[model samples]
Target: MASNKPAPEAPSRFGSEYVDDFATRPATAFGTEYGADYATDYGTDRGSDFGNDFRADETGPERAWEEWNPTEESVRPVRGKHRVAKQRNGLARSSTVLGVGVIAAVGAGGMATAQSKPPVSISLPDSIADNLPDAKSLPGVGALFSGGSEAEAQEAVVASAPLTTAGITTAEAEQGSTDAGEALRARILQQAEQQQDAADAEVKAAAETAAAEKAAAEAKKQQDAAEAKIAAEKKKAAEEAAKKAEALRLAKLAASYAIPTSSYTITSTFGEAGSMWSSGYHTGLDFAAPTGTPIKAIHSGTVKSAGYSGSYGYRTVLELEDGTELWFCHQSSMDVSIGQRVTTGDTIGRVGATGNVTGPHLHLEVHTADGTGIDPMAWLRARGLTV
Candidate 1:
């Protein structure tokens, strides 16, 4: 009585179209002709009737219902998974709002923390310590920090900290008069001047000390030089006095027998006609007189040399006490022989021009024991004679 084919399913208004969980009308999962399409199933499983499991594969001709165009009704909003896009947009907006609130909270917390804190203060260990004598009292630190009196120290501190007029106004407050500010300025200037005066005094003192030291050194040097000069002069005077005393004693001993020439004059002195004498000089006096002029000894002495020396013709030398020698040269003849003792008045030679001389004369000279010639005029003067 019934046909052997299955009955057609209920017709949908969108032919072969169905509503997904999102409420969007999609074409049948299976293609037309009631087989499976290639799409995967995403619903509850049932029997082969495919009521719960969607047909996921089909190899049939394209369906006319699959080509249906979108309509206002199909795009209408619905509930459940249909609102998924709106939920996602709402979640993004909420997350952004939450992030902004968290940032704002953190910023507020940071401001509050900063406002609650106190400003940092500066201090040094020396500022609080009372046991220490002062900054200058530390070991090896006295030279580093200049020392000063109490007043000078206060002045220095004020000078180092200058205050501007505007700063003063602020510090005094609006109720205070400008006179107070002027007074402060004057005080600061006074302090600075005091400090400068102290430093200037110190510098002056140091300079004075240096000058004093230099003066002391110069004074010491001068004293030393003066002492040395005095010592030298004293020694020289003592030596000269001793020499004079010795000379006087010797003169007294020789004076008893010494004699001056009775009739002869000093016609020539020693060292006369130096160019003609073999010894480079006529090293004796020449007394010009008659053929037999009397030649006398200046003191009691032994004849040391009596001979006819070259250019001297005839010569005689007398050796006195204290190692003195007297030379008689340019003589016509010698009256004394060698080693013969003669008084001051004894005739040792006669006046003549026997040596390389221009006229008849007698030459005389005096010498030390060592044979060094001495000024005969000086020797004669020492004996109280003007010759």
Candidate 2:
């Protein structure tokens, strides 16, 4: 027969002191004796005990140990949750690397395509096509775009090709630039030529004007010369006509007067100097003739006196209309009476040897209205008589 009392409890593996403390302290998942200081060790030692400490009835280290000891299935999810998060981060890093690789591959492919392909086709309008150079004929155009060595031959074929999305070819752009430069140069040359032409025109006009002026001056000179010649001819004609008129007047005057005597020789002229006269010079003209030669009147006039003087024998005085007195001395006889009218060429007296004469001669004297005598030979010549 056994007594009914329980046996004494065994000491804990931790120690009796720990068990005694655990019995006296408040209940916790980790034993009160272990407290916060032993919790990490207990959790680490019972890492597989998951269901032990979580029970309501379990307390202290016993419950902590039981709860801490867990199966692999129960704890596997917690570690797997963190591992899933890490695996997601790694996947994101792998995606970023793959995207970068794809971008690099696409960029390389685009660069290769751009280097191999030709540029875009450019169509010229019909109006400008005739003026532009053939696209293929441009340098490097056929080889660079049309895939041909002969640029000229490939021009037509390339022109018919379909249009592409690329831009204008390099050759076409260069041709356009060259054409524009040529056009600008042509315009400049044209303007220069026009300016030169205008200058030439101005010079020609000036030359023409100068030539015209010179011609006009020459014409004027010729005209002046002609006018001078004409004027000189007219003056000469007028002088000749005046000379003819004077000759006619002198002829008529000669017809109006007559000589005093005819067939007589002149012995002495008026103003002759000799020792024969009472004065120092002979004052009358002498005409020697036969003693009975007839004496004519010099002009139409009245007989002023007829008488015999001391040295003059049978002298007669005739008075003309102008009051000039003509005296005929040493006459044989007086034909006209005193105060009788006489005509030209009338026989007024005859020549004779007078008292003072050396031989038979007629002494003719001319006296003015005041009785002043002048040379009778000059007086006869003034009346158009040669005597």
Candidate 3:
């Protein structure tokens, strides 16, 4: 182990002098250290140089300490330079912008949601109940929507909301939609009936028109036939009247052709003298005169005879083409010979009482060519001469 030894002391001073021992230099100590040590060391002296230095520091004498403001090192100027963007700064700004965009998107989405909402009400009419038919009365209708879900029932009720609120029964609401359906069925039936009636009326009218036309045509035809018959009858009557007039004219012509040969006082008619004469009382008219009275022809004719006869002394006969013979008997002189042509009022002979004559007279006889005797007065009356 090492010996524990203390270190040697350093040199010492006493007051204001270097001294080996301080008490031995009391005068130097008083004038130096011991004299003003407290006052000069800390400037606490009242009248020493140290005291003067303290007073000067308080009184600003000769600037013992200068006035001191804070320099750049103490309070550096507040930095005004714009800060650069870094990852940390960018993150803060991005967070603020994202917050505003989220707010705007939220507002736009809320408006779209409001616009897409459905209506809660519907409109319907009162008279809709009268149109529907009863579903209960229809065949197989009860099983149509039976055993359905509540959602199905809600849908069905909502669909039938128009009818139910209009006071329609559930049975009636199941039948149809509108009143127009019922009206259409009724209109169809009524139109069919009307068509049948119209067709029947048209047929009847056509038959009536045809009948009227036929009747009119028949009446016209009958009238035409009647007119034709009347015309034929009138023509026949006119022709008959003309024939009668011609006959009358011919009869008048015949009556004017007769003449009497002798002018006599007493005459014998043609048929009445037969009973009074010996062969005949007088065959002709008797003119009581002397003999030789002139005899003339009554009409133009050819002389057929001028000879004697048994009862009459001479006789003359004339004939005409119409087969009439004129005889003159008891002539005294015959001027007309046989085959001689004589004219009316020509002197043919002289009247004489030659044979069987009570007085001078002439017997005249008119005979047909077939020797048939007729009434001479009647025959002459037919020639249009009054005899």
Name the TM-score of candidate 2.
0.43
Q: Residue-wise lDDT of candidate 1 within 137-222, one digit each (tens)?
A: 44344444776566666666555424333345554545453465675776699799999999999999999999999999999999
Q: How close is each model in CA RMSD to the real structure?
A: 24.2, 28.8, 40.0
Candidate 3, residues 1-387: lDDT per residue as tens digits?
A: 232233332222222232213213344443354333322322233223223443311322122232247887987866664333223434643343334333332332221111122334654465775566666433344334476566665566555544323544355446652444454565578799899999999999999999999999999999999988998898999899987886788565544333545454445557674643676644454444446767777777899888998777788988986868987887888987899988767888887877766677777777898987766656655554454
Off by over 4 Å in 2: 1-232
Candidates ranked, most accurate by TM-score first = 2, 3, 1
| Candidate 1 residue spans exceeding 4 A from truth | 1-197, 200-281, 304-315, 321-325, 329-338, 345-359, 365-386
lDDT of 2 by residue, 200-286 (tens): 999999999999999999999999999998999998999999878877776776787888888989989998888888887898999
Instruction: Give the distance in Å from residue 256's predicted Cα in candidate 2 to where it truly belongs.
Output: 2.4
**Best candidate according to TM-score:** 2
Cα deviation of 275 in candidate 1 (Å)? 6.9
Model 3: residues with Cα > 4 Å off, grouped in runs? 1-258, 277-293, 352-360
Q: How far out, in Å, is residue 291 in model 2?
A: 1.8
The models' CA-based lDDT, in order, is: 0.60, 0.69, 0.59
